[model samples]
Target: MTDTLTTLRAQLLASVAVIDEALKAVPPEAVQLDLPKPAAFFDRLRGRLWPRMSVSQVQGCERILAACGHAGFGLAWTAYVLATAYHESGYRMQPIKELGGDAYLSKYDTGRLAERLGNTPEADGDGVLYAGRGDVMITGLDNYVRATVELRRLGIIGEDVDLAKTPERVLEPAISAAILIYGMRDGWFTGRGLDDLLPRTGSATVGQFTKARPIVNSMDKAAPIAGYAIDFQAALFAGGWA
Candidate 1:
């Protein structure tokens, strides 16, 4: 179901409270991860999960970390968002265009996908126009419009910006970072928020990472993404994310 502004606002406030409590629940000295081996951790992540992982990827994660703090998300929440970007962007850790041409993307223009995406059934190229761009690959007209609304509500964007008009703006690093966190945190892309995935806010176990997959899409790559999330959790800890 499409979320009304009021409904979204309510979810926003509730998620805020949950995040606040979740952040507070962490012990001040809790560094559950191993020693702060920043270099080795990076080596492992880069060598295995992302062979070409670069400084840009780390910087991108740092940006998301900053947004997580701005949104009061704890390590678990932030790590999941990072891992999602890892999977969605194909380890680029940067905004990338969704693959596929008009014929393929057009499937989103009419039928169940169109209804879900809140696009018209005219097959007028909404899919091609609104193809996913950003850390998390959110697609379609309604998703873009909702991103505008949520970003504005989060104070990440302003009145001057309309994502539906300048959809490429979502590709900007800051906007992409904000979209990843906000969409997953408040369930903009899907009605299932982080609260739905974790048994407790900010305390998702590794297995639960699989469930969080629904925040963006179905369990298309849940296992691999979950592994990525676990690795990210460790790497972020190594990078002093706690």
Candidate 2:
């Protein structure tokens, strides 16, 4: 493996170890009530989709999970998302589920859709159209428009990008993880951070622990078998498991 890939793999392995250790100290019964059976959810989705969906659909999501390091809650998150993706629109092969395919999907009026939404900058040659497409769950024109500008500022994307054109950017796991982590740190998440997210009624009703339980349980199940599981949980504790 390349040095960069090796380094990232090591980091991912370390993170998984942290999560594994933290879970061991906490009793499964204590967290059992919060856990959901993602497998059951998966089965229901498969039945509904019927002949249209296939195992390949599930495999596609697992590929993403593996790319991002299948550790702790991340693995469970992958299952949840994969199930959703299969049930939602069948892996985005359909135009309706595609963020940029449907003309109506641009209600947010940012990035690429701004011009169509009657924004004056439609005539501006220096607009970058943003389509929050693909696995990172990018959404709305505004996000892409802003991200394009940000990328330009960082010298990663050019300033004169066409807003009318679909935005293109890398989506590898490490890049995606970097974007997600740095984005959260930059106050990009819906709720500030874990601390801010935890106290809100929306969050409390759902419960942070509740959302995390399935993955935690899955991680616990996988810990003994996963070579790096022990160290992953330890890192999380060090990082405060937030």
Candidate 3:
């Protein structure tokens, strides 16, 4: 890692550890209720949480912060995105064809025809179908199709590449992370800065994301590129960028 990245990583890790400690003190239910609405309260939480995200999460935060030009806004953005992921994929794995296996893609789709049915789900195999994709949490093939085209257009991913055949592209943390960033950039669904607000909003602030439409739009335009770069760097660190 570059000196700047290393320094930033240490700082971020330090902050996240502190935040984790603080969060541990507060029950998940309490954390959920401490939503920041007022500027004063939001600022207080922001100041405390800004330095508390994990290094990786902070790296993601830095990318958003630079894109939005507001440190406070970035935390909100992160929370929104991660919360969506929690809602969509739980930061855990989903059992869809894209992330689960080739057999998860249903046989009755254009994607299967496009892939020449290279892979199909069998009744005896991975039975789950219609997995989610990208950040802001896109679900089903319809959404993935839209995002694949968008990623191709943005040069973040390749066009004509079969999303079904490459499940790793959907599940790889780096790829998944980048796509979340990219989807936000592409105005996926709301195109809101959910990832940025994740920290300040906490669990209780789920309703706030619905209110911040413009910030979401801005994040939608910028997150893909920034996330792609950061995720790629992270992939390199994990020896998976190639």
Give the candidate number with the greatest TM-score: 1
lDDT of 1 by residue, 15-105 (tens): 9999889869753322133224557657657766766667888666556666666666666787788789988888878888898888888
Q: State TM-scores per candidate.
A: 0.78, 0.36, 0.38
Tens-place lDDT per residue, model 2, 22-103, is: 9897534323322144354335444443434455555443343333232223422323333323222334312122434334
lDDT, residue 32, candidate 3: 30
Better of 1 and 3 by TM-score: 1
Candidate 1 residues lying further than 4 Å off, grouped into runs, are: 1-41, 199-203
TM-score: model 3 vs. ground truth: 0.38
Q: Against the true structure, whose lDDT is highest?
A: 1
Q: Which sequence of candidate numbers ranks them by lDDT, best first?
A: 1, 3, 2
* Model 2 ranges off by over 4 Å: 1-56, 70-128, 140-142, 145-166, 170-189, 192-242
For TM-score, candidate 2 versus 3, the one ahead is 3
RMSD of 3: 15.3
- Which pairs clash in the backbone of model 1? none
lDDT per residue (tens digit) for residues 184-227 in model 3: 54455454444443344223232445444443333333433233
Full-model lDDT for every candidate: 0.78, 0.37, 0.42
